[model samples]
Target: MSLTWAPALERPDLLAEPVRHALEAMASDGADVAAVEVTEIDPDHADTAVLVEATGWDLRDMANCIVISGARAGEERVCAALVLGHTRADVNKAVRKRLDVRKCSFMPMDEAVGRSGMEYGGITPVGVPSGWPVLVDARVVQREHIVIGSGLRRSKLRLPGALAARLPGAEVVEDLALEPPT
Candidate 1:
């Protein structure tokens, strides 16, 4: 379906380099996905809350990609956790248990941006480090298509939710996020 929200990923200018590269790689392997850049926003204000309000997008159609790390002695093991914007990742319970670690927390902003090679507030699951799991909430894939960060604050990705489920080292976990109180 042609999307009125954003244009095709055929033009590299429409997406961040990393995101375009990731999408190109996916397309080369025959995965279908698309992305678009949103004009008139300060990159520093690209967090989910800001983007959602700025673009007038439905919260349920969007998900936040957060880099989280587990406690380890020598080296930290980090994973990209994707959860619906309306809910929060279950870091203390679900994530810690899933990672099999005593404690887990959101990666420091500097480290997350540095290691992921993506801008802060614009981290996406497409090009995460190899072997790092992309834990996607089950609710995410149930949607036909969803919006995600583009590894750059200027743009966003619209793609089949199942594509996230198929990303490298992806783990589709139930209740990865805890819903907010009604």
Candidate 2:
């Protein structure tokens, strides 16, 4: 089925507060963002499927999907989003390099939930903490629109690709991926 924007698809009962907040924030900024619900799949599993479907030039392309989790810095917690599938956030190398952290890792589940104020699977790139850095893959902008997480595993959000790059504290960058370990 084709994708379409519809608020009714948001599944409010399952919508994560951070995602809700992000959507509201984007709306306040004059962006037209909407959410759609679909079957849930583990990010790893989904990655494989996404790759199989992305033939031709699309394989190298980036899609805007939010993967929210708490990043650990000693006892501190930070929420983050990275573009989907083919690209890795370079969390260990590039992201840490960019953030100037000696070491970095995905936020622990509990910390991610606490900081984001949203359930683990429900986090979206939209309503994350104001100061949290948003890293967008430069390749994602090539698409006119993108489908990102809606703060919930069962749903996805659709919005202008450019708006994602404009999110507060977001920094658009190129070469966000690292070659998978051989």
Best by lDDT: 1
Give me the overall lDDT of model 2.
Answer: 0.56
lDDT of 2 at 171: 78
Error of 2 at 71 (Å): 9.8
In the range 1-182, model 1's lDDT, one tens digit per residue, is 12345553654554666666767677788765543323324575578787777668789888899999986676677889999889899999989888888888999999998888888877998788787899999999897777887777766677777777977778999999999998
Worst lDDT run of 10 residues, candidate 2, spans 55-64
Pairs that clash in candidate 2 = 22-126, 22-127, 70-107, 71-107, 122-151, 122-152, 123-151
* Candidate 1 ranges with C-alpha deviation above 4 Å: 1-8, 34-45
Model 2 regions lying over 4 Å from their true place:
1-4, 7-14, 34-79, 179-182
Q: Pick the candidate with the highest TM-score.
A: 1
Which lDDT tens digits does candidate 2 get at residues 1-182? 33334662355544566666655676677765543233343443234345235322244333533433333465443436556446667666666666656666776667666666755555556667776777777766666666555565555555566776777667777766554577
